[model samples]
Target: MVDDTGQKQTPNTLEEPLDLNRLSLDEQIYVNMRNDREFQGRLHACDQHLNTILGDVEETVTTIEIDEETYGEMHTSTKWNTSMLFGQEDGFVLVAPSLRVG
Candidate 1:
């Protein structure tokens, strides 16, 4: 099943339930990130650095925090240019990296 977006949802296994309401805020963010094409690409690249990753076909959530300087660099990286187009006028913009389903 697909959410509001046209992106197809991954099928859930017997161990995983097909319910969005049960998802946490972080999980929801991860799903939206996965649906975005550009963010998806970035996640694919960063997946290698993530540890203790866990998730099924339908969804996954990973926690990662970088230093303030590194975070700033990441924000300015060329990979994030497309996101900047959305404009920065709004305060407290929340961004989640896309899922790198393997």
Candidate 2:
């Protein structure tokens, strides 16, 4: 296969889920974390345990509160930016398009 730039594309032979992170090195990626937290950043490094280091990160956290009287859920979203961050393996809920199952 060839990419848009006409460069030959290698087959995505991902033997393990962690291999996806390897392919995403130095590239933009989105990670969904526990507790309604989400992160978008450039992947700097990752380990076999799924722990990752990211740069130029944007983090978003969402919280839901129930109105006692109205019985309605109110959602609050908070966003912040950071130069770099380290993500622990267990904190990750989901990672982006790189990892897929057939």
Candidate 3:
């Protein structure tokens, strides 16, 4: 198919959306989860259901609260790292170019 840049783009033979994860094997990826939780890690393994096993993982959790006095919203983010992590299919996974590393 022709892209906006007038360049030809070849479509992948992915049967389903999750099939995109196969291309990210052994690569760094990002996962955005519920409750303001996020993950960044190397894609060690993944399944058809989008469940994944990651290595060298970093997890971030953002908590939002309101100040009792000012009634203003306060945001706090906490991060930690682990040697390995297993993530359920409860969120969205990202591959290269979209993966955020910091």
Candidate 4:
């Protein structure tokens, strides 16, 4: 869903997880800010909640060992303004002034 600022909020789903491993460094940080509980019931509500769920973040990097031969990493820096929400589409849809994460 798109907000007043034209920012999009993508809903999360059980079948699909927010794969932090696929995200880049900047994206990870953005996820962190999005998933902050304190920011919930606010503009970044969905973002914060999802980070709490799927983003195994520490300091700046969220690591994933895909397999014995393959691994993935997500690193983040400063947070950015609410622009888009990336995740699965199942349970929720963006309803302005009342956002749901999962």
CA lDDT scores, all candidates in order: 0.30, 0.88, 0.79, 0.32
Off by over 4 Å in 4: 1-76, 89-102
In TM-score terms, candidate 4 sits at: 0.15
Off by over 4 Å in 2: 1-12, 97-102
- The residue ranges of model 3 lying beyond 4 angstroms of the native Cα positions read 1-15, 91-102
Q: Is candidate 3 or candidate 4 better by TM-score?
A: 3
lDDT of 3 by residue, 18-72 (tens): 7668767888888888668888898989998778898999999999999999999
TM-score of each model, paired residue for residue: 0.16, 0.80, 0.74, 0.15
Clashes of 4: 6
For candidate 2, lDDT tens digit of each residue in 1-102? 776687776766465788788888988899999879999999999998888999999999999999999999999999999999999989898888444447
- Model 2: weakest 10-residue lDDT segment is 93-102
lDDT of 1 by residue, 1-102 (tens): 775567667644122332321232124233233322222212211121121122322322343456686563222222322221221212212334344379
What order do you get sorting by lDDT, best first?
Answer: 2, 3, 4, 1
| Candidate 3: pairs in clash | none
Model 4 over residues 17-100: C-alpha lDDT tens digits? 333322322333322232321111222223424432223323232333344455544443442233344443232332222222
Clashing pairs in 4: 25-75, 34-47, 34-48, 35-47, 35-48, 36-48
Superposition error at 41 for model 2 (Å) = 0.5
